[model samples]
Target: MTMEDKREPKRRNPAKTQARILDAAFELFSSQGYARTGMREVAERADVATSLVVRYFGTKAALFEQALVRAIYERGFFVRSKPNFGERMAALVVGDEEARIPAMMVLAIADLESREIAQKITRDVVLKSLADWLGPPDAQNRALHMLTLMNGFTIQTRHLRTGDVPPESVRWLARSLQAIVDEENAPVN
Candidate 1:
């Protein structure tokens, strides 16, 4: 080939590469924490050379971000899939449609985890979307708080521990959050 032709590197399909890398990272990271997942593992899973992962994601940190983002969106956190916050939250509480939140939690607490990145994305992409479609700031906080409560609650529920939060408390929390939203949206004198 001519020097000009040699200089022109073959342009691989970006979307396909992104999906393959994400799929590989998701499998590895979901099973093993970020630190434990190596580029080789993802490459093997993706049926691509390890260098391709580096080319696509730059670093494992970046790869993890793509993996997590895809997992969240791919979990079916969309309105067409489920139209209500209760349904959405409930899915998360038990397990999302993808059953990856528990794995995500473990991954998030890993040394390489980036809660700042996670929260920002969660808020900007996940929470903000839900808020705009659902309600206001209070609704936003409510969703966040509920997520925390569910996290703890699910752990206890799994162990069948005593002093568990009653169903009524969950109901109260939901109603109170709604009240806060209503109060904020109320007309000022």
Candidate 2:
């Protein structure tokens, strides 16, 4: 066959390509971090041309921000369903190591590198959404407490390597959080 006949067919769907790029970008940005990761690397990971990445995202910083946001929501940080929600959350926090560590690291970078207003706005919106999911009677407070616990767990275990805290400890933490939920739902005399 001639060289012209050997060329591969082009991708027909822009949306699918964009989604793939975003997913690849999120994974790389999370694992390698924003500062360390490059546009070429992101494009390479996405299996697209570097020009396509720039055409879609404009710049590496913009790509990082968008990727980080997608990663946050994709993790379902505020979309917990009831009836064993706590257990489900525990499974995500403990089981999803690939997503967890990178999220924490990228969040740290966002805090340090991005604007304060962006972080504050994201924090407020996420807390409100989570609180709403959690229900009333100091839902905001409960949500914040739960977030604090999760983020701290991420920082301590993944970053600090704080003593080999076993899987059972994580289970206990989930149970303790569930106790809070149960107490809140209990009827008063």
Error of 2 at 64 (Å): 2.5
Report the C-alpha lDDT of model 1 over 92-174, residue by residue, as the tens digit.
Answer: 55443344554554455656355555665676776666555445446676556655655565555433557655676556544
In model 1, what is the error at residue 10, expressed in angstroms?
A: 12
Cα distance off (Å), candidate 1, residue 15: 1.9
Alpha carbon deviation, residue 122, candidate 1 (Å): 3.3
Q: CA lDDT of 124 in candidate 2?
A: 62
Give all TM-scores, in the order shown.
Answer: 0.65, 0.79
* Tens digits of per-residue lDDT for model 2, 1-189: 998899998757888888889888777765656667788988899899999999999987677667666666766765655767667666666664544533534354554563442365357656677777788777878877877677676666566675776888778768866765665687755
Stretches of model 2 off by over 4 angstroms after superposition: 1-9, 75-77, 97-102, 105-107, 114-121, 162-164, 186-189
Q: Which ten residues in a row have the lowest lDDT in candidate 1?
A: 80-89
C-alpha local distance difference test of each model: 0.64, 0.69
Q: Which candidate ranks first by lDDT, i.e. highest?
A: 2
